[model samples]
Target: MVRGKIQMKFIENESSRLVTFSKRKNGLLKKARELSVLCDAEVALIIFSQKGRLFQFSSSNMENTIEKYLEHGKEEETTTNNTEVQQHVQPLKHEGAFTAKKIEFFESSKRKLLGQDLGTCSVEELHDIHIQLENSLKTIRARKAELYKEDIKKSKAKEKFLFQENTRLRKQCGRKPNQTPEKQKEIASCSQRTVSLEVVTDLFIGLPPFQ
Candidate 1:
């Protein structure tokens, strides 16, 4: 008859739990021995009881076998850790090199902007720089033209003020307003003739005392 599957769990009763532990420990050791002899393999097993008792089995010296297992595990762990480090370091090295090259390119470009280190530039690079310079010069000239226009406006204002002052002074001196250029020349000549007549009158008065 096919038997029902038993639900596996800890035996609750202390007596039954102890009984089960003894039986399972012996069975496990017996199986280890059988497997070692049948397969011609080294075997080791260890068990701890609920009461803190130790039970163990080994095909060879138990201490040496345990030590060998531990050493082998440590060697495998070390190798795995080294492999992981190499995998991570390889990508980091590539990234560092890429970053360094980018920084170098930026520094070289900066040098070029400052008009330094131009000896090794190719013809195309020089042409590009010339175009940039030409655009900058155009901007500068446009700014200069604007400044020149402002200065011309200021000069016109100053000339207007001077002309107004000259006209006021001429009016104060009893000169006619809006006289033509020819009329101005005639006035100057009449003023000169009056001065000559005064000088001759002074000379005749002084000559009578001399006679």
Candidate 2:
């Protein structure tokens, strides 16, 4: 048979309230035990009567379960606190941090390279900076020379292609072709020089010192 929902109110009579509390407390404990056993879950429940009577249940050792619960709660609290701190601190950039110090060091080094701050540098440090500048200059010059050679090679190839086209056009127009063997030999020699330049490495190419 279907029964209407029970009214939600405190039991006013002292005897009825005690009986109700005993029945409901036992029912709740039974439910907790069933849940733990049926779902293979850990469950704990604690009850206090109006007279300060204590009732408790646990799927395992009650002390151990309570300790585990407290530990888990503390960990969650720590995680939440850490998240809040990060959220607030990130917007503030936590000025004067390690990363900020590193950036400042890099900027100081850059200024030194630009010759803006030399008062703090010693003679040995100055010599090291000078060596660094020399190495950088050599690399820059090497790259520039490589690009210049490439441009020259491309220009020569384009010139040769255009000359061949001009010769073909001249023959079609019944004009004497001006591509003589000497001109062809000069073009071939120029191409060979470009190829030789491309082969030249940045290594020292001088005779050994005399003993």
Candidate 3:
């Protein structure tokens, strides 16, 4: 008699669930034991009840069987990782070779640009090289103009900062907010005299003492 396929679903009733769990757990352990004995193989099984009870079976010492299983799993994982690394490395190796070739080509082109290796170029090639050089020169000129503009901007900012600092220092020194031309000339003369005095002091510092 052919038995119809069972429609599997979760047992919602607590009592029915417990009964099914007990029956299935026992049958699974029995089959594991039978397989271990008949085939002379290491077998292990583990189960957990809904109430958090532990059930387990092993053909030999459970600890040893579990340790061996864990070791086997680690070995398989290591092999898989090594394979993946090799697969990834192969493409990188190919790309490295391609990059090296590209760099060599650019170096050769640079030599041609400097007129160091033009013995093999035809007329058309020479004309193309001339156009490339002209374009490169234009680009360089544009870059230089941009740099000059940036430098001018920085110089203007520095000048403004220095002017503000001078004004602040003058105020701190009790200088009049408005200075006459005669007062400015007097200030400049005083500054020159102070600098000369500092130089004279420095020159005499290393002089020998008179006996």
Predicted candidate 1 versus true structure: per-residue lDDT over 1-211, tens digit per residue:
9999857997789998888889889999999999999998899999999878999999999999999999999999999999999999999999999999999998998888679899999999989888888998999999999999999999978866776787788899999665654576799999999988875434353446644
| Clash count in backbone of candidate 1 | 0
Candidate 2 yields a Cα-based lDDT of 0.90
TM-score of 1: 0.55
Global lDDT scores for all candidate models: 0.89, 0.90, 0.90
Give candidate 2 regions above 4 Å deviation. 1-84, 87-96, 180-211
Off by over 4 Å in 1: 114-124, 130-211
Clashing pairs in 3: none
TM-scores of the candidates in the order shown: 0.55, 0.47, 0.57
User: Where is model 2 poorest over a 10-residue stretch in terms of lDDT?
Assistant: 200-209
Q: Arrange candidates, best lDDT first.
A: 2, 3, 1
Worst 10 residues of 3 by lDDT: 198-207
lDDT of 1: 0.89
